[model samples]
Target: MDWRPWLTRWSEEWIGCTAPDELDPDVVRDGWLGFAPASPEAVAAAEERLGTGLPPSYREFLLTTDGWRDAGCFVSRMSDTSTLDWVRDLEPYWQDWEEPDDEEGDAEGGPISRGLLISLEADAGILFLDPGDVDESGEWAAYSLFSWLAEPPTRFPSFIALMESLYAEFHEMRRPEGATRDSWEAQVEEARRHALAGDIDAAEPVLAKAEDFGLSRATVLRAQILLLIGRTYEAEQLLGRLLHPSFTPDGFFADPLFAEEFLPLLFAEHARSSSPGHNSILQSALIGDPPELQLIIAEHQARLRRGAARATYGNPEFDDLVHAALERHATDPDALWRAVGEALPRWRPRSTDHIAPVALLTHPVLADTLTPERGRALLSQPRGDHR
Candidate 1:
């Protein structure tokens, strides 16, 4: 379908785009935006809808605000365990979202399940999303995203205000009596009040209610608030769900903007001295990683064969580790080989997928250890690890 032209009409009529000068509009004929970058509003909405509170970071993300972040599908349609847990608790209302259709229906439908993530692109340099999925009014959502992309706002205040204004209007028209919408506005007010009074606890209740109002982007703001207050686990959980690779485009990852914002703390918060677990996974990400470091390692390795991210593994930030790994591997082939093998488990490493082929091809024991035989063998199975 002519998504661009269609988006133009939709944006003007639904999102209050009176003229082209008010917004930029376009058609994403090719390329993509990293999926599921994370939305503070969505997280908050999800929580309030379920009558539960998300982790402090997630909630704080909602309370906090920003303009543009990474958008588009960077992860697969799969849900991380944490997301699965939250969704298990919220499966009812999300029922409206399309499930992973075993039969890929039309170009417009996009991925199978909902709960998508907004991730970062290694090279595309723009955020993207299914014009149909995220937009409340499919055509309007598409149009609004187009307009924003055409003329990306320079400031967070403008971005937040613009979306808030649009969503507020969208909700009023679509769900006038829905307590969910009313609760969302109330929560925003509540969060504002709590912040003013310095009673963060008081803010929690309203933030909780706001999320119920279908304002998932609030999670982004709330996560910021939680981080400011040092509630890392909850923040991790919310961000984890927000950036999990499973929610993005087929080959996309997490949002670079989100990574830039959280990486400093992410390392200190989740890294383990040793072993490939959650923390490692989150920390090792050159760009898009989950909440923990080890899990980062595990997930990156799982995605090694993706040609698009060939240089991800040996990111400049990670060169030291690679150098160290190279040195250690050179000195102790056995130990190094063991680590390489360890990297091969279920998930792929970001380094291996995007690192220069020469660098990876040069690893003396890489071919021997991460052999196609073994790599294929390990990944060939019908694993439910990420998906």
Candidate 2:
């Protein structure tokens, strides 16, 4: 899609919404958000100098505006044709840092050593386009490398896609509702409130949208929603992205809902799958936990070896309940699950936040109870009203 109109709109909205202190003095004085378009000769010179043709979206961007201000919250300026150069030439030291192997679908090293640097000023990050990985439409893969991000550089399909994501991040931070893109933070809060109240159906879509806007917590919330609807595999896949050997149950992880509900669901999935790919995730995650948690993992592993393994929710009380339910040996697991679901709300946590433990609604035992119609009814009901 042509980004000129949207870019112009984004610039205007940014100029209108940004505070005077944050706006560049020149921008405020001139009431202009971008530089004059680059001449064909200038564009040709950069392409010839770099020995690779510039991608269409970026080339079109230069034709629209040779340079741009506030490309994102951190990028103070975008390179004009005159200033654009290869990342290797501009920052050769980038090649010295060892590139990690690709995890999941994340690209290795982000091609930083072989990319076209697009941004002129990056306060804490750099934006580059990888000409080596082009799509059918000839748009190069774009990357946003941030200093604080522990993982590989965030990749986009094209320059336009990268710019759109940056713009979305801008909207997420500024919350300029009714100005450009919808406010992702607002959507996240709305989804959180709904999910906590046991309205997963209502919350799921908003959470999904917030996830698209780079809200990490939204992924967690959406995973819970997926679990509530009995989509255990999908939920497991989503949570897998967030899980790492070094994951700490601190900060947001310490939240009562996340600690009590989400973690258990993830651990349960790990035990059930025991796939070779994720075997190490469980091993690394359990290291340095409380002695009780360690014992649980050890016992679970022993049971797995004996071919008599059972899923545990990672909480002692809940595990006891699960053991009791299994001991009953009722012919119908669904009936047993329904009983467990009914008791979930009363399962108190170690934390003070008495926000209804909706996370328990995702227990593997209760999956059978979350049939489409029943799941919708269960999730739509207010907290404490689940049958």
Candidate 3:
């Protein structure tokens, strides 16, 4: 794929953008959001010096612009042709990290010790491409590693794919509304409305975008939508991240729908999940909380100790449907979800006496069962709290 258009668009969008002190002065002087393109001779010399053919996509990228600026939140500079070198040459001890078994390489040394280091300036992060893992199209697999990430290094199929994802992160940070606080707030509210009206397909993407920009409300709203769609696993994943130790819960739980209705259901689900360390994660989130919130947390803990049934929609009608589903299809999880499909019309929103929370969207399994009339009924429910 052509790199010029992508780089041009990124540059155009980043006009007057300010970054950390790691920002390269060359980026500001070039007027292209990148340094001048490397000459064919310079590219050839790097290839000869490295003793390995550069991947096509990255080579094309270098010919377009020798290096990049602000590659991602942590990676401030992409290495120029002159600076490109092997990871082992720069950070030999990186081999101390064990390699993934599935990958074909030195049994002990992974991408960090075997790959080409492509990033020049980063905040406790490493970006590299593994030539040994080249695809049929000659694009090397790229890895983004950061000290703060507890998970394995994030991988992309190719150089451009990695760059595009980084560009998306950049856009998330500098939205068209111009980086002011709460720029994405309007989108979150609109998405909440869409989710309540049973247009979850419309709502989810917006909520996901807002969540990417670090809004706790968006994360909560999106997780509720995930649960409503019968995506219990996905919802729990979001909940796990939302309650991560680094996450602050200042403005969260202020919404009564979240505090009163959602938290109980979340705790009940946590009880059923029995995922290791989740209880500790929950307790960690409650540290330094006000007395009322502490009481609320204690109540959920007590209920879990008493072996409370896993809460579904917080409405008796819905819980009954879920219980019936469990009984009728004890051997087949998909069948139980299908039963949820059949129960959508009978399912009432827990907050209906007031207004809807994201809990109103019928499960995706309910897709086949949602007639136009049923869809309208789902959409027309009252939503959210008086406050």
> Candidate 2 at 367: error in angstroms?
8.0
**Regions of model 1 farther than 4 Å from truth:** 1-179, 182-186, 189-197, 212-214, 245-259, 270-274, 277-387
Worst 10 residues of 1 by lDDT: 66-75
Model 1 TM-score is 0.25
Which of the numbered candidates is closest to the native, going by highest TM-score? 3
- Model 3 TM: 0.64
Return whichever of 2 and 3 wins on TM-score: 3
Q: In terms of lDDT, which candidate is stronger, 1 or 2?
A: 2
Go through the candidates in order and give the C-alpha RMSD of each one to the true structure. Answer: 22.0, 9.6, 7.6
- Estimate the overall C-alpha local distance difference test score of candidate 1: 0.37
What is candidate 3's CA lDDT for residue 165? 78
Evaluate residue 162 in candidate 1 and report its C-alpha lDDT on the 0 to 100 scale. 31
Per-candidate TM-score against the hidden true structure: 0.25, 0.58, 0.64
State how far residue 269 of model 1 sits from its true place (Å).
3.6
